[model samples]
Target: MEMVDWNLAVATATRLVRPGPEVSREEARDIVAELRRHAKASEEHVRAFTRMEAANPEDADTPVLVVDRPGWVRANVAGFRELLAPLLGKVEERRASIPGGAVLGAVGGKVTGVEVGMLLSFLASRVLGQYETFAPASRELPGATESGGRLLLVAPNIVHVERELDVDPHDFRMWVCLHEETHRTQFTAVPWLRDHIQMEIQSFLGETEIDPSTLLERLREAAQSLTGAKPEAEEGADAEDEPSGESRGSIVELVQTPAQREILGRLTAVMSLLEGHADYVMDGVGPQVVPSVAEIREKFQKRRATGAGRLDQALRKLLGLDAKLRQYRDGERFVRAVVEEVGMDGFNKVWTSPNTLPTKAEIAKPADWIARVHRKAD
Candidate 1:
């Protein structure tokens, strides 16, 4: 039984994400060149303020790509496929273990594919730049390497957002690069980070099971609701339970098993650390290199709080994006608070080993991590 047809997912995503106004080959080339110029300075800025024990493992000499919306969707779909490979394999095995499971498996795969495709369709327009630490399989797809563990700057989205914000275009571009390049430097310089995060994700996935019958039931109910067959009163409870517009407490509500929740807690704490550190590094470089940094940050934060339309806002809520946003704010606060009390060197200790990483509670109260970590040192 096939768990998911990744190719079909990619195709559906590509079709759903409407193509932007076409750019000539020359324009695309120029976009990549311009971003590359900014990237060099951005890298230098991050390095000047931060120190890591290990040398960056990534091919720093590699170029960044400037992709359009469809390209972004295709790349991310490939990434999701690679990322979820093991979990889906387990699902397939579990399905086959059941009596008359083949038909159920096929239905599950198709439904999952469509759901993922639709999610990516909306996300394609929102992301700016990413440092994909996990490399895509080179032998599998022709253009996979371009989308692998390298820097990706989505050109159209960047251009559109910058224009809309009325900020300094050059400065804004550099600000964006600072964030992405910091992430690149993070996984590269910390060496163990990539493997550590991948392992945690795998552990989380291992504990997560997809019950075909339960999934089928949910799909039937959803279909009925969409067709307006369900009464309004029946939908009230579901709407009320829909997370009250996103909060820290609701962050792990989607995970089913206790093991998954435990793994998710660890994963969330680590992400908070990584994302917080990146934000700290980006702002630490400050107004000297990125002169309009404050202005850019202010406008960007406002933009995130409110999306383009009701559909975009709804997607963000449904996708737990607000929860993700809170991570940045929460993490930044934790990092700032910790660094204020213990200096940069003391805060750097968190990156030394996974054991030293913050817990969810520690993330909310930075002093707890500082005291515990430093006490061990003494």
Candidate 2:
């Protein structure tokens, strides 16, 4: 059981991600200042909405962390490393007992780390901001001490996307902040939420396989997909094309074990609820505050739907981001339906406890959830 050097993992990810367009000191300062300004406004708006939506009132005192793409990669790398360490350790322990497994185990962590770094780098380029509530280890670090359970806005990526979409940059930036702030309020107001989500993640990781064969197979398939010719149907396929990767490779589809399935089902339900609620809040926060909110949402969604190059599309499909897009849509629908039927306060029952969350089936059939949640009270 060779120990994985988490430091090496972060270093590898940092190197691969590198830094995006260089921001001058003045530019950096301005970016931070603008995000901070929006952060405050977003907090106020989101906090008010969250209270109305969930019947929970709360506030986050921690200042937002405005960073660049590279900075995001670094922070995520650290977070992921800490979160996955226990599972990696367990893998190492199992491998040590197997013949010839020790040698592979020694290098396995490094390889996994590299893979993680690569993935995070890709995501960092796309994610505008995140409310990171899962990294307790990150909180111990100097700069991250006060960052736990706080909002993190990637200033550069937000700017880059706004420019690419040719939308109102200020409006777009504030919109992004609004979304993140909604998440911040969700976790802050529901103190148990952070722990619950973290626990689900840990349980899922406990069931995950850190086997070399599994990773190797995925890498080989990725290579093949990258090098393979596109089918005629896919030649001009839009970016919103359905994912082409095999379902077996998808984490969402890999819940075969009974325990894993149970945990996954719960996790999925919680994720759908949270994501849907955030989407609803972000959009429902009113356009008077963000004049271009509608335009921003339309363009942003279109951007996701538009496929990039073959290699890029393949990478996205392999990463299961396609499933994530569905999560957003499905979750949004669930929240909207439940609210329409039961009203905001009734929908708030979901936040009361794990028992009240909608199941996967319930997410698809919002009426079932409404009936169950309401029936119990009756």
Top candidate on lDDT is: 1
lDDT (10s digit) by residue, model 2, range 104-185: 7668767766766677767777888887755553443222233355578988788788888999978888888888887877
Can you give the TM-score per candidate against the true fold?
A: 0.85, 0.85
Return the clash pairs for model 2, or none: 239-306, 239-307, 240-305
- Computed on alpha carbons, the lDDT of every model, listed in order, comes to 0.73, 0.72
Give the per-residue lDDT digits (tens) of candidate 1, residues 94-133.
8788887888777867876787787788888788988765
**Residue ranges of candidate 2 with Cα displaced over 4 Å:** 1-3, 18-24, 52-59, 98-103, 137-147, 209-258, 376-378
Task: List candidate 1 stretches off by more than 4 Å.
Answer: 21-27, 53-59, 97-100, 137-148, 217-252, 376-378
Residue-level lDDT for 32 in candidate 2: 84
Candidate 2 structure lDDT: 0.72
